[model samples]
Target: MNMKRNSVGDKVFDCFNLTGLFILVGLILYPLLFVAIASLSEPDQIYNAAFLLWPKGFQLESYRIVMENPDIWIGFVNTIVYTVSGTLISMILSVLGAYPLSRSDFKGRRFFSFFITFTIFFSAIGGMIPLYFVIDKLGMLNTMWSAILPGGVVVLNMIIIRSYFETKIPMEVQESAALDGCGNFRLLFSIILPLSKPVLAIMILFYFVHHWNAFFYALIFITEKDKYPLQLVLREILVNNNLNNLLPTMTDQNYLERLKQQQSLKYAAIVITTLPVLVLYPFVSKHFKEGLLVGSVKG
Candidate 1:
């Protein structure tokens, strides 16, 4: 076997590649680190933009403001409800919709597939206006259903799930189950779902993040302030930060201190809102990786 050797030019290119990679990593990681540090730093430091990679001072005043607000808790609870319920709804519809479409022997499979792909490139016949009217007629306005139903199952994601089922799951296994008198429902849940952990985990995470970050639908469809999701509440917080007196019992001097903490509060709110999802990513990261790699490449 011939020995592998790097020429001077290749060595230079390798050094450049490593330098560029380091710069790219720093670019991505520095912002997250900076935000975390700035959240805990004194407000004036944030206003002055003094904190670089590390925080200059330690302060919990911004977190205190966020924690003291009872409405923020209500928003958290509402967001959790919406995310969990919405993800469940989304997965149910996606699986049901994807499963049938994945079967090779299903009637009109090519026709249905073409129709779905067509819609991806084209708008609906009446668009958002008619869709809103239908939703209003359903009396789903101002209810959680309004958030869950409007775009529960994305066609593109459904296609991904369909491709997963079509490729990752062997036809022989399905045929064996059918021989054992397993019906469609039994085959779907008992056989296919158990084998679809990687795809399912990724889908759940995707839908959860989508629902958690959703604000536009909640803004339009939800009427009550109590019903607002965390994102909406966070937006309102930033918009009215200086005006709202966080601690009424505090003296004027202390209140002014709190006003100075407005910028810090914005950073704190970002960390607080994003922390849960960030915490969640590791648990499903392996599945997410496997699913994307497998689902994205189909034979």
Candidate 2:
């Protein structure tokens, strides 16, 4: 009877603990919710502070202005290009590098691994001028390959992938493949990569987010506004002193209305930038915990 009573008390405590955790999370996330709601609220009501939780007067004007800017669409396209291309490149290189590092029999493998790993600890702090000089020397400036080639592989992601391959892929299986006339490329593509879906998914998510949000590279290498990524375009609109790009067509009264509208649209643009990862993450989130743990383990 006492045990049963104790169990009941424990259950009640657990329930309250969960509820408190949720309330705490809600408190933290409220600002984001408020920003989202405020973005859609009416300009007059926003200025008046009449709306708190709900939008006082709903308006799509901010989005309309944001959409009207030609650069925004161009930047969106560029961002898509950069993200997709960069992610593919990152995955290919990381996979190739990690697969080799997973093997102990490869000649000078430890030396090679140390060589590759050396870049992670060091910081390169030179600005656009030095990078520009190097790119110019290579004659890659103003080219699409400029963006694609510079950051093709991320060292940290590669380390995670290599760890996963080392821990998860059995040495006996690889040895069997070797005996059966399977070469490095065939074993990697046909065996290793196929079984590394979880870690690969996590790497894809990481590289995708990195490439999508990258602006400094584009800002320096891409002189053409047509090549500007979405982040750069957003920076120009929000941080840089260039309001004319989005607000050029607005008249005096409409300009005031538009400026107010942009205040909300800025948040909406953030939501737009953030939306893809949110959508992609949930579908692959199940693998994240397993992949990250397995892929990053030492042994």
Candidate 3:
């Protein structure tokens, strides 16, 4: 059989599509590329350049300054702990909640699901004050648990996992397991979870990124500098411009030089903070499309 040849109109459409996509990809990538390059380039060159194509006067000084700060290291370690612990908590809660809701035999599943979903819209109407009060009442304020526990279950993620279970997993497989004297916990642990790797990987990626980049709750709840996450620490450097911690002892002689280096320092901090998510996406990317398509389609 001969393949159909592309007509003139189709060729034009394909060319336009390719051109648009290339431009879109460049638009998205340019800023990230600039930041990475700027982080390594000399401060004067970075400021003077209209756009960065490559590093100029390449040096590791910005990275050295960022790494040398005790706060940066503390925040990095804190972020890792929060990301790991929070992801584990979120996965456990989301799976446990979604599994039951996915079951047709489970009573009140619809009502429970509705109740959970209601919060998504209701939360948009304003709940920050109430949430703060509750956290304060529970004495979780200024604690690491404040950041990790409050967002332990994301509703959208749970719904996605539930949709994945209901639509992707075959009922016949579950029935077969049940017939072989498999109990709920055993079946879930041994069979169901193993087969649900794609969705689980996606969920892990979602929660991991969320927890890794979270700062709002930390900004509100964590007053102690040592307890701050990486994002919050970056905020101190980037937004507040509080580079006292990152800068070496300043005198009239080197004050201008240190101030110039601040630009590189800020870009370096952003790159450092962003690197983890970039590193993580590749590992779970294989499951991303499959899981997202199935998981998000129903809801």
Candidate 4:
């Protein structure tokens, strides 16, 4: 078989496309690269340079400081707890909700699905005040449950899972399982869940990342410093510049030095917070595109 040859215009287009993609990649990557470099670079050197391609006057002081901070460690633990618990709750609720809606024979499936989707739009229309009042009425304010329970089921994620269940899993397979004396719970746990790993993996990744990075809810609900998640703690450092608690008391002589170190500390905190998501993506990435494509297409 003969392969089609590229015309001159096609060749030019390919070159331009490749060039544009490379530039876009660079634009995306450079900020992350700069942050990583800045975390290691000498604090003074960071401000001195216009653009960083590499670490300047490398030092481990910023990392050492971050690691030594008890609050960072506390925040790290709190974040892990919240992420794991919240993700589990979200996934469980989403799967339970999605599975029922996916079944054509399930009564009120359309009504329930429409109701869930309606909440999404309602949520967009200044729902935060109502939600806060609900949380308060439930007496969950200033507790971990406030952060975890309120956003337990994301409508869009549930919709994706429902779409995947409807389109990917054939009705015959379910009927066969039923005929073989499988109960609904058994079939869901044994057969449906096992076959739905790709979509599940993607959903887990989505929920995990969201919980890991979430801070707004934490900020509103958690008043105690100890209860703050990693992102909330990071917000104090990066947004509020409240490092006095993190840093040791400084004498007048070294106050300027400590101030300079704050720059590196900010970058170091960013690296630490972002590292988990970066590490996690590679594991579930293979399922990401296929799962998202199939799940979204039908819905």
lDDT of 3 by residue, 55-134 (tens): 99999999998999999999999999999999999999999999999899999998998999998987632578888998
lDDT of each: 0.85, 0.82, 0.91, 0.90
lDDT per residue (tens digit) for residues 1-299 in model 2: 45535588889999999999999998998877877777788767777784378877888777777778788888888889889989998899999888888888888899988888887776443666787888889998877667767778889999999999899989889999999999999999999989999999999999998898887777778888888789988888679647676655767767677767667767667666667777888877899887998789877
TM-score of each: 0.91, 0.87, 0.95, 0.95
Q: Candidate 3: worst 10 consecutive residues by lDDT?
A: 121-130
* Highest lDDT model number: 3
Candidate 1 lDDT over residue span 13-90, tens digit each: 999999999999999998999889999988877767754767767888788887777777888999999999999999
Cα deviation at 79, candidate 3, in Å, is 0.8
Write down the RMSD of candidate 2 (Cα, Å): 3.1
Q: For model 4, which pairs clash?
A: none
- By the TM-score metric, which is better: model 1 or model 4? 4
> What is the clash count for each candidate, in the order shown?
0, 0, 0, 0
Pick by lDDT: 3 or 4, better one: 3
Give each prediction's root-mean-square deviation over alpha carbons: 2.4, 3.1, 1.7, 1.7
lDDT of 4 at 31: 95
Q: Give residue 260's error in model 3 in angstroms.
A: 1.8
